[model samples]
Target: MVGYFGANLDGAKPLNYDDYLKVPQLINLQECKSTPAHHDEMLFIIIHQTYELWFRLILHECDSAVEAMAKDNVVLAEKQLGRVVEIKRILVQQIHILETMLPSDFLAFRDHLKPASGFQSAQFREVEIVCGLKDERILTAFDDQPEALARLKKRLSSTTLADSFYNLLSRNNFNVSPPPERSQTELWQSWQEKTAKELVRLYLAPSEYYEFYRLAERLIEIDEYTNLWRYHHVRMVERMIGSKIGTGGSDGVAYLQRTLGYKFFPELWLIRSYLT
Candidate 1:
């Protein structure tokens, strides 16, 4: 009964482990859509479900990191980003777990997932937006889902990790501004160049900005692990489906390959080129 998960139990009844953790509800969430339920269908569903959970935690840590940067608490911000970097490592490793499924086994239940794709993962989009990958094209995919659209709109309007990092640097007397009257692309290029120069200074004299240097390193690690996840995911898909169209109407491996270039902290990585 739903009452089993209720928290109103007083002295008359002690809280049990199952009730405390909602184990009953959690275990029942996986529902295979395959007729007669193909064995691998459960694996596919659980892998994706687990991915969403990781995305949720990534969003949570990113929010905290942004808040820490807002307060110019670089130590706290770096700590939060450290957790995100570790989570991304786990994500990259976790995608390979899908390789455990034989291609034939996945096909047995693949049809049941048509029109429902990981492309619709709003939380994943939220994570990208929060990390500075705000693409409005993703909004069109969620036009039919009111809650997802609303959440994404809020994320779009929110300050991103890149914004927080730049603001933190500006507060510390770094010149983070781009000159006015440039075209959009030029403006972004100028901004990256400015940030890259400042990052080079940090790299050259890390002891002077040690906290910030560590924070920048964590940002780079997060971006690296994100690309690693994308790479592994594309390889896994290709291994399973071999350039086939995605169930969610995407170009499958090709579409994922395009995402390999996404960078949440471009300036952090660009600094490497100027390190010498």
Candidate 2:
């Protein structure tokens, strides 16, 4: 009964893999139309869907970290971020899985799909916004989903991961800022601005907080890996689909190109500039 999963103590079945799979709705693969039978259609579905499921997990870990950071719960936030880094490794591995599909194989089923591009993936977009990719133009895709749109708008507008990093730097007594800017840059610029700000702050502060400064640098390393993963995805997709528009209506190659330029934690890299 539904009660079994609903925390009902009575008539509860012991849980194991076999027992769990016996349930009526434990991820039954629905039969959807597969075009031209790419001969590797199952593999294709598995890869993309698995990536999505992984994205969901990524969001779970990253969002928890963001929420923790907001409370200045540094220890808890680090744990959450550690989970995110673990998940990022998994996400990175999937790129290789997708590479298994040759260009010809992808093209066969490509026409079967409409313009339902990854650009329209609200979840991925949220992850970007969380990582400081705050371009207002990217928000138009979710106009139909008012709640999701609203949430992205809020995340874009508020203190993002970059803001949290800045606060972290401030906690350590760094007080840097960039040359006055009239507008905000999304992910890439977000990191740059943060870096630029922190570099100055750390230098200006009267000699102390070295330990806190190290923590900021470590997080920047994590963001660097994340940026690499995102760029790798863009390249992989570009290899498979070329500049042709995504089935999701996004400008395929151009979109990927644009995304490559984003850096989620600018301050880390900016400090590197000051290192020399």
Candidate 3:
């Protein structure tokens, strides 16, 4: 109704997905029960729809960050990344909402869905791959859809945000190639120290990456929240599904637990230890 009933109905032009997607039609909020899907079908639809909305935000941030990076618009990229961090918090917090459903509630609609799972969400997988969680098993979740699988594959092969930061450090005269673990040579150690200093400079002043630092911290925050979300998800799954595997054949709680070890920015984590 926002477009159809608004005064600017004819004038309001939708330029992007968010700007264009009107309610209900794209939302798909209807109960499957109206068409004999399941008892908890409405709830199921709403949860997934909400998850998609979050993915939209994630995509929006990523698009902005990439564009900013293309222009060497460090400040802009940082701001965009910061927003993503906020979105990450939102994603983590949503686990509570998901947990509200009792085992009985989900079991009512469980059978209505066949093979469809969160693992099948293309956008969510894109977010993971973009952030550099490049495990092949994660990509396997979408093998049924060649298009989704291809896109995920492309992102996995692309440079990640963490890679961007390292490249930036190298550009700024702080030679960071393999990071600390692989950096054993004295020359490498010297460069990493210099790189750390340059990072402080880049993230603190004289460049847009200053904003990028704030943004980087936000990303870290997002990771923390996402881990919390996963933890909560595992707990909820236990309460709801027990030891049963995920809908996409993942090991459910065990799978979620495994994801907790994934890191998007290895350099950022290393900096704290190096600096302190």
Candidate 4:
């Protein structure tokens, strides 16, 4: 039966849609853990599953963009970053679909999800790390999950998108040296000032540095859409369960609200104020 479903047994068959994408396996993964299997539970599972899949694709595009930038291929990096921006738009829109589920409908299955909160989403954290939002503290939560812990550790130790961008600028002869790491907040603020000054120069002579100017704008779009996604997410969560604690032991809406203030590329945003 497994062979009939296009398993690699005998290895003699052409690939079909199910073989290529494993549609059969993918469709079967929505097994509801709720007692009696609440109808809304399926929607909840599929929505979050789709989110993780999109998050995976976003991470792929981000890595590609960073690689392209490292190679001084601004065009390729811009193209890949454009793809990430579009995917984030889709992410923002997807929240509304979950909001369509009435609060009572979610409550029916929410209890079954205790300790399985979206806070534990390893892929989402990977996306954050790849996009330059590394926080070592978050890794402590996944200590029991060795596979995830390993991946997060690798991300923590690696050069992030922000690092690669500055390196790209340095290759182009911009002064991208960051201040000493006395404190993360201080380092970020110092870097922000330095980067904004450089970006302001680029903005003034955009035709001369057309590619870098465009890259900076694309980075700003990424920052903008990320904040939009967070804002929409917080609104959706509040609508679903006002002030309630999250399934993963978080403060739920409050925690998400706090995250809205985080900017992956603050210099990209701050440059606007310095622009003529």
The candidate that wins on TM-score is 1
- Which model scores highest in lDDT? 1
In model 3, the worst 10-residue window by lDDT is 175-184
Query: What are the Cα lDDT values of the candidates?
Result: 0.87, 0.66, 0.67, 0.84
Residue-level lDDT tens digits of model 3 in 112-170: 56567777888887787666555666776676789888887888677666566566545
- Clashing residue pairs in candidate 1 are none
TM-score for candidate 4, please give it.
Answer: 0.92
Cand. 1 TM to true fold = 0.93
Query: By summed lDDT, which 10 consecutive residues of candidate 2 come out lowest?
Result: 176-185
lDDT of 2: 0.66
Model 4, 162-259: lDDT tens per residue? 78788888888898853223247777688788878877888889999998888877877888888998999999999999999999888999999999
Better of 1 and 4 by TM-score: 1
Give the C-alpha lDDT of model 4: 0.84
Error of 2 at 269 (Å): 0.3
User: Clash number for every model?
Assistant: 0, 15, 1, 0
Residue-pair clash count for candidate 1? 0
lDDT of 4 at 203: 83
Error of 4 at 151 (Å): 0.3
Please give me the total number of clashing residue pairs in predicted model 3: 1
